[model samples]
Target: MKAKNGLNYESNPKHTPGGQGFRPNAGIEPVNSFELFGESVSVNLKDKIHKSRYTMDNKGNIHRFSPDNRGNYHWSGSTADKIKLNIPN
Candidate 1:
């Protein structure tokens, strides 16, 4: 059957038109909130690595924070506003 997007769902509903399978939250970890820079920020455990951290603001914008050589965290950059964690504090 053809889906509304014109993709053949009969073959595999899990895949899209280009054959890329849909994996919801594929590599995403649970979201946790933390107080960073005096503001409540939501962070994905998956984005927390040894060198950097990723946080989401209230407007669903992603911001990257990394530590300097002196071990002070600073805003690195902003990422695409795709993932939103609306979990309450």
Candidate 2:
């Protein structure tokens, strides 16, 4: 999921009768919002860099999420609560 974000570049292929050429593909359109635990949270990408970001809650605890080069997402927060779930690709 993180790899699919706008931070990376993709290839745009153009084919003709004889050959094909490639160019840098544009990034996906920015997503301005997303749902979090059934609640819609606004997304802000203006200050976001690369493939990681941090979110802070009202209690002063910080939540963080980012993806590693190996295609696994790493998550850590100030709280110890854990939940079992899978994010389908």
In lDDT terms, which candidate is top?
1
Candidate 2 lDDT over residue span 1-89, tens digit each: 32333232221122112225422231211122111111212245666444544444455443444445764433322232243122212
Show the lowest summed lDDT stretch of 10 residues, model 2.
Answer: 29-38
TM-scores of the models, in the order given:
0.36, 0.27
Per-candidate Cα lDDT values, in order, are 0.38, 0.31
Per-residue accuracy of model 1 over 1-89 as CA lDDT, tens digit each: 32232322122212222335634532222132223323423355555534555556676665554445654454433444234333321
- Residue-pair clashes, model 2: 0
Model 2 misplaced regions, further than 4 Å: 1-48, 70-72, 77-89
Candidate 1 residue runs with Cα over 4 Å from true position: 1-48, 80-89
Q: What's the true lDDT of residue 53 in model 2?
A: 43
C-alpha displacement of 7 in model 2, angstroms?
13
Model 1: number of clashes? 0
